[model samples]
Target chain A: MDCSFENEIHLEQLMPLIEEYLAQGKPVKFSPRGISMLPMLRQGVDSVILESYKGVPRKYDIPLYRRDDGCFVLHRVVKVGKTYTCIGDNQFNLEHGIRHDQIIAIVTGFYRGTKYYSVNNMGYLLYSRIWHCSRGIRHFCGRCLAGIRRRLR
Target chain B: MKIKDGYIVREVAGTTVVLPTGDDLDLTKMIKLNDTGKFLWQELQQDTDEDRLVAALLREYSVDEATARAGVQRFVNKLKDNGLLI
Candidate 1:
């Protein structure tokens, strides 16, 4: 007989704190959305635990958003400025600039598929790089697909 | 917005982008876009109507009046046909 250990993170277990950091800019949860965080996080599936992002976030780092519509958006931080600017990795340009105080957390980890990984560690930067460098082209393709998706139905 | 010159567009991370061509979307089977197609997509996001969109494309891409008008019409028709337009 053998015994093994594995770590599991659950969404119900994660939501309260995520709500906290996110709304108050205190302890936050940076849930994954869309394909921008791809190769790192999955769309509509992956999620992360975030703390109050205190320092400046670097280019290619993912940031949690409280959008103008009061909806939260999670996208990549593409430029470091007095007001941080983020865009989806496959986007044409930075969608909006947020005050530093508005950011909930810089994504420190990712959950791809069923496995959990640390963005602070190795093997993750490569994924981030591909998303950043290829953003423009990726957005182009995605927009094309959006058109196609509409047509197919 | 029209795509900048010398680069094609692609989608990554759910956002439309303009990069070198040839990168195919490999994640989901749906929601993919090419460069010129992305330029058209951006225009839809803006407040401009179809005629303004055609004019803008002509200025940016520097195509002849007929070509730009035709491209914009095709893209807008596709958008309407697909129910993306109101």
Candidate 2:
């Protein structure tokens, strides 16, 4: 997903509405939670923009899943197979495969503050490749940032 | 709580199912289950206690105690591995 649809929100304010949107079939939203999609999504800053699933996702499309435990995540599909295999752009390890039925939304666009971008466009291609190449370093940085967030929280 | 509580689980056509109620879930993290797993899931909703659940499945499926216990244990292990249970 590219950064395009930005909705300003405080963490406290965003949470309730995100919850409500999920329950109401309203436009889905959430603050990016990790650097998994780093350089594309920023933790605690970039806001996610989701379109309800309209069909099976194609390669490179970002999709969201509602895990049995109820946490939601956004990741890009690396492979479309008997099960969809998704991976974070800036991270190692493929996430567990999810059936097409498990997908809740397709990330049609993204917003980093006020800037918007499209996933299908060239601007996103450059960013995604950079993210893929620097994944090792970015993942290390991401883990450190995660630890800091945990302690601060 | 109601069986579904604040959430709704409804099957939609073409694998693009919907979970229209509750929190915005990160669907990417879910561990996809096969038919056996789905059957075991419904059974969990009916009863989660380990022993009682095993007993019920034993009766319902007309399986021997050993076979039922093994099946229950394997399924429960998978659930735990996926972080679906405490």
Candidate 3:
């Protein structure tokens, strides 16, 4: 079966298999194709390991959820009470009132090449915290001065 | 050589995708095994050699010795390059 080729598969067709793997308590690994969680996750570079989400996702946890119209998304939770308020790291708008049932899996860790970083890693925690905390200013500046400086430097 | 542990063969949208459970290997590589690759992967699940692989392929497909040997060699080299074989 060594005749391997690259092919693009729709997420809708792939999500069920991922969910099945997660439900078996197995962490599914794949390279997510999107720019929503950009900087942290690239379109075709970084790979993420996901496990089935158990309960309410806490603040800052990245969960793969489906929108009512059948759109799938991966975003960070900002507010969690009866419902969740999530926004992508690369986007400004807050998506409100997402119920727990809507969430499929939570990112446990990720990799850049062979380097793996856990969600609980101090550096990752700091990065996510700073990114989310500075979202307000970043959104206001429409691309903050600090971010530009960091990129430039 | 044998196929490394933690790799699984799954079909998605008519493509046979390879996913790894082991994190130690490079996670950035997305592997899609073609039909021949899939068959040899099954053969490599256990300890095997080049001759054995070529023989297996010959038995399975209506191909000549040179073709089967070349296919096995190429696939083996690819697996080795990707660290999919131990």
Clashes of each: 34, 16, 12
TM-score of each prediction: 0.45, 0.46, 0.69
Better of 1 and 3 by DockQ: 3
- DockQ order of candidates, best first? 3, 2, 1
In terms of docking quality, model 3 is acceptable
Cα deviation at B79, candidate 3, in Å, is 0.7
Chain A TM-scores, candidates in order: 0.65, 0.66, 0.86
- Model 1 CA lDDT for position A39: 53
lDDT: the better of candidates 1 and 2: 2
> Which lDDT tens digits does candidate 3 get at residues A59-149?
9999989999999888999999999999989988999999888999899998876689999999999999999999888887975776888
User: DockQ of each model against the real complex?
Assistant: 0.01, 0.03, 0.29
Instruction: Tell me the spans in candidate 1 whose CA falls farther than 4 Å from its real position.
Output: A1-39, A139-153, B1-86
C-alpha lDDT (0 to 100) for residue B69 of candidate 1: 76
Model 2's alpha-carbon lDDT is: 0.61
